[model samples]
Target: MAPENTPVHIIQLIKEITGFIQKGSPITYLGCPLYIGRQRIIYYSDLVAKVMKKISGWQSKILSVGGRATLIKHVLQSISIHNMAAISPPKTTIQYMKRVIADFLWGWDKEKKKISLGILGNS
Candidate 1:
């Protein structure tokens, strides 16, 4: 595929030489979307879903809070780092991930214990 403003003759020549069909942008490359235009949260939805899936999978396991924290640091973080390093994810996505982690650590029932994440982090 040719860049914007590329002459039609040149594009035709390249297509003829290589017999390649032209395609559009927004294709997934190395598990990341490569496209021109403004970035949107939708692009990173997969990353969010991945984090949720990982956390949900562990819900069945009986683990201590420390174990949950370890999984968050090692497993969840690793899953997101690749996409995060490539592009900045929306704050909403980050917040959702944090909330999910906190819920997993403290138990889903609000009445169980409602502690600020900052406070939880210190302890």
Candidate 2:
């Protein structure tokens, strides 16, 4: 009900109509964040971070290219499928996911500015 910069909105319940309770924006439905209307990408950062942690664990392991691709295509994609179904993901969120997947697929080296997309000796 308020702009992005604005703070909390208060709701006063009617003493006469003592049946329902009032809730606010940005509640979680199932595992996804639920809000009345459009929300910024930052809200979903924690969800993305959860996914990143999953990928990070796998990053250290030695898996074949096909295996990695499968995880990306199936597991990674499915993680946010429910959230995406509920609402469109912000551009930044999508980009962040892509970057994470790409980095996981091709080992990210601290020295290199960009990942090599190294699929040469995948097996």
Q: Number of the top candidate by lDDT?
A: 1
Q: Per-prediction TM-score, please?
A: 0.67, 0.64
Q: lDDT scores for all predictions?
A: 0.75, 0.70
For model 2, residues 1-123, the per-residue Cα lDDT tens digits are 334664333223342356545456666676687765678787787679878888977854689867887887788778888888887878788878777777777667657776445432221
Q: Distance from true position, residue 56, model 2, in Å?
A: 2.0
**Candidate 2 Cα RMSD after full superposition onto the native fold (Å):** 7.3
Q: Which stretches of candidate 2 lie over 4 Å from their true place?
A: 1-25, 110-123
RMSDs, each prediction? 5.6, 7.3
lDDT per residue (tens digit) for residues 81-110 in model 1: 777788777777677777877787777887
Quote the positional error of residue 40 for candidate 2 in Å. 1.0
Model 1's alpha-carbon lDDT is: 0.75
